[model samples]
Target: MMNFRKAATAAGLVLGIVTGLVGPAAADVPAAIKERGKVLIAIDVSHPPYGMLDSQARETGSDVETAKLLAEDMGVALEIVPVSGANRVPSLLSRKVDMVIASFSITEERKKVIDYSRPYGVIPVVISAPQDMGIAAPADLAGQALAVARGTTADIELSRIVKESGVNARIVRYEDEATTNTAVATGQQKILAAALSTANEVSEQNPGLNLEVKLDMAAYPMAVGLRKGDDELKAWVDEWVGQNLENGKLNAIYEKYFHQPLPDVIPES
Candidate 1:
């Protein structure tokens, strides 16, 4: 479903432009961002509870609210650039976005290119289906088809597990989270590999469908992704996260969407 060759080619196409865009200001980005008077942030609005569009097409979610707060703190305008999970890094690298505050989970592979603020949230990744499916273990997924959003860490990890374990399941990758969720909710697909919050959104939106989490893949720490070498910007963002987290502002945002308070201490990646 995912064309790895195409992805590689796309990355190559952007490499030259991204390299040119990474100037000295990329290292001292806080001053540059202030001078610009607006901070560009990339977010995946297709992912619900974290980032999504409301009924009126306004961006409203935990991540969106958090970005607003960050902008207010910086005394800058907030510009949200819509992005798919696959292009977040490319957007940041090309200077299309100052940072990414979507459910940008920190991972070893991603860290090789971008710096990340200490984690602000933990999101659970899971494989979900109706209660009747009873997916109790990895073996239960064998020969089954699971809908997944393309290029998400959940998709990458799920693919790894399936391949390494020699499971015969099929991974149906969609262009975005909304499509993946729609496929499962509409009965076009029987199972979903996505965040716990995403699966919950699908079930909530389509009340008649009783989608339920059947397997807990893992809980990932989400952070703000910054350009590599932007130590000053990263430090400022880390401090901002700590202040909001300690004062309960971040937890308040989390509770608004998650319906529960954040943990006393958000685990670091």
Candidate 2:
């Protein structure tokens, strides 16, 4: 698991207010990026329905499709740069990628490090446990062990829940979702796995490992990320997303992965 203490401290852990939708414009962005002939997009090649490597090793998912559409709207080529949960921000900061279309949550803390475009989806963070656990709520987590993805908002939300609720559940972090899911499924740790999206994917695959709980601990609004100070790029992506939503393209992407309509655009409150 990635170190949250250091990352949170470096980014400052403050509750964030939702932001209103901003119209996209082409006037303020860099000419190079606007006309570079290609948009370098960072995507997670391991997380399915968000960004993942298919059997053919091709990047496929809602995030990738949406990004490709955005690139087309800009009249640019789409270059998918594979990334992971921990490296999404670093990839953009280091210029390894121009923008991250991964399942990135837009938070006030993250805003300190990178700019987030309009929200694409709001995923409720929940717990996935084995069939015999009988765990069903945050309180049930007391004195239990839980598994979380290394650098996810699930980690942040779980930490906050434990601290605020005065629960004694030990949070055991893992390198990736596959590892966490495997551990939980096999009863290696008897730990509950936390997730933001694709709870059905985890449950469907692990029929033996039942999702015993559905705590709406937090609703994480996922968005695209850009390097700080890229207001022009932010606006462009934001506008593109809005147009897709209106055209029903965005909802199609959401249903393809989630088997449901996308959550409404939630402004920070």
Candidate 3:
């Protein structure tokens, strides 16, 4: 059995090599990407609905599927590289991955370090708490424990709100969205700030927890992130996004994972 597995792996590698050499080159692709014959996309595998591992430990989610589609459209193989929120930008900057599609929100602060494609989707950062927690607003979070994945948009916005509003909430930072949601569901934390889609999944998975969105911190436009000034790759990605948006291909991917229609708030540009 082991020998058969090994032989199968070897055969697949040979097939890939042959295909890479003979496949039609994607037009207008960056030279580096074209030479590689594959696009390495960085994704936050711990963030469900956006990106996550399935029961078989294979990457599956909206962003993962979208990445696959983009690679197909580009006539290349797709390679997914798992990354954490804090390390995604650094991963791209270090040339570890060709691009990032990890629900990367476009922000003025991030634009200084990396270039972004046009908005592909929108996600709201929301504050959620147990139904009985009495946390109805951001101001109500004062003196309560709030869990958030460090380095995420939720963490940044929640921290800013606490500081600016003089809310003395205890911000408990976790390594990733899964852990943060677990903390809340297990009653270790009474409040959590996370993407709405993530919160919805957590609530659905742990129905007994009865988590409810208490406040919406902000709505952010998400886009693909490329290394700064990589004009060729950035332009290709932006054009892909535009075409997908118009053709309804992107919306179909979103609806598959989210189990709902894509929100109208997604910016066309």
Q: Each model's TM-score? A: 0.87, 0.83, 0.87
Question: Comparing 1 and 2 by lDDT, which wins?
Answer: 1
Whichever of 2 and 3 has more TM-score, that candidate is: 3
> Which pairs of residues clash in candidate 1, taking residues 3 or more apart in a chain or in different chains?
none
- What are the runs in model 2 whose C-alpha is more than 4 Å off? 1-29
lDDT of 1 at 92: 91
RMSD per prediction, one decimal? 10.9, 9.1, 11.2
Candidate 1 vs candidate 2, TM-score winner: 1
Query: Against the true structure, whose lDDT is highest?
Result: 1
Order of quality (lDDT)? 1, 3, 2
The TM-score obtained by model 1 is: 0.87
How high is the lDDT of residue 79 in model 2? 90
Residue-wise C-alpha lDDT for candidate 1, range 70-95, written one tens digit per residue: 88877789999999888888999998
Candidate 2, 93-197: lDDT as tens digits: 999888998878877778888888867676677766655766666788877887887787777788888898898889998876667767766767665545546
TM accuracy, model 2:
0.83
